[model samples]
Target: MSANIEKLQQVISSYFGTSEPIDESTVAADIDGWDSLAHASLMIRVEEEFDVQFPMEAIWKLKNVGEMASLIAKLREGA
Candidate 1:
């Protein structure tokens, strides 16, 4: 995995208090604190961590880690 991917998973796991590995296909519903409110918080955390902001519309569409990574990559590149 890329360092960025590893760091992303680490941040997510830490937020959820889970040691289980997270992958591209991991769904948000499968993790604790991944509900609507936490989802928003997660997006904010990601933006802060990656130093990039995402569109609110796009944030609502991120259903899995892969989508989130792709969005994050796009935002980072745009930045």
Candidate 2:
């Protein structure tokens, strides 16, 4: 896996307190304790970790772990 994806998995695991490994196909809806509140918290954590800010309009468009990782990578590249 790419470093970004690995870091994203770590963030997701830490934020959601999941012992299982997260992959690109992992969906927020499928994870335990991944409700709206947790999703917000996870997003904040990801932004902080990557030092990239996601626009509000784009936040809600994220569907799965792969999408989140891709966005992070794109932001980092543009930075």
Candidate 3:
């Protein structure tokens, strides 16, 4: 797993109390508590953990953990 994925898994585990291992393919629909109500809050926490704000369009584009990690890497690279 990449460092970004590890950190993101930690964030998801912390915020959602998910004990199972999460990987690149994990998505919101795969989690028990990651419903629409919690989506925004989870994103906020993820952004806070990475210390990077996601663009509005990029938010919609993130389909899984890998994509999110990729976007984070790309955004950080541009910084």
Candidate 4:
């Protein structure tokens, strides 16, 4: 895995307090307590971890962990 993905997994794992492996295919339903409100907070945590702001329009478009990691990777590249 890329360092970005490793760290992304770390952040998510820490957030959910789980050691369960999260992959590109992982979705909200795969984790406990991953409701709508948790999704918002988790996104904020992602932005903070990557030090990149997510555009409002793009935030809602993130469908899975892979998309989130891709966006973070792109933002870091453009930085």
Candidate 5:
């Protein structure tokens, strides 16, 4: 679980260009650079990293790092 969170953190940091302190509590609205395009890019990166495809609704519903981690876990389970 810790390793998964670390990988997700790395992916998010890579997408955002720096490790700007994030967690499950870090919301999209709270992140300064989070926009639609970036969100799309994040989804792509996450999909590639986790080897799973997320539904559009899931993509839209992801709010923070913790939520993303949970989503990844769920997708991994289904996979």
Candidate 6:
């Protein structure tokens, strides 16, 4: 896995309290702790870790881990 994806998985595992490895196809709906509140918290953690702010539109559109990683890469590239 790429470094970004690995870091993303780490954040996700920490947020969701899951030891199971997450992959690109992992969606919010696939996790037990991925509720609305957890989603918000996860976003915050991701922003803090990556030092990037996600626009509201892009935030809501993220459906899976792969998409999140892609968005993070795009945002970092633009930075």
Best by TM-score: 6
**Tens digits of per-residue lDDT for model 6, 44-73:** 999999999999888888989999999999
lDDT of 3 by residue, 1-79 (tens): 8999999999998898979779999988888898877888888998888889999888876898899999998988987
Candidate number that wins on TM-score, 2 or 5: 2
Candidates' C-alpha lDDT: 0.83, 0.87, 0.88, 0.87, 0.80, 0.90
Worst 10 residues of 5 by lDDT: 22-31
Question: Per-residue lDDT for 64 in model 5?
Answer: 72
> Arrange candidates by TM-score, highest first: which order?
6, 2, 3, 4, 1, 5
Q: Please provide TM-scores, in order, for all candidate models, with all chains considered together.
A: 0.89, 0.92, 0.92, 0.91, 0.84, 0.93
Which stretch of 10 consecutive residues in model 3 shows the poorest summed lDDT? 56-65
Model 6, poorest ten-residue lDDT window?
29-38
Q: Judged by TM-score relative to the true structure, which candidate is superior, 1 or 6?
A: 6
Model 3: colliding residue pairs: none
The clash tally of candidate 3 reads 0
Q: Report how far residue 32 has shifted in candidate 3, in Å.
A: 0.8
What lDDT does candidate 6 reach at residue 60?
Answer: 81
Q: What is the lDDT of residue 60 in candidate 5?
A: 84
Q: Which candidate number has the best lDDT?
A: 6
Candidate 6's C-alpha runs over 4 A off are none
Model 3's TM-score against the true structure: 0.92
lDDT (C-alpha) at residue 47 in model 2: 95
Which lDDT tens digits does candidate 4 get at residues 9-32? 899999999888898888888888
In the range 1-79, model 5's lDDT, one tens digit per residue, is 4666889878887777866876667777666688877899888988999898988888887767788888888888887
Candidate 5 residue 4 C-alpha distance from true site, Å: 2.1
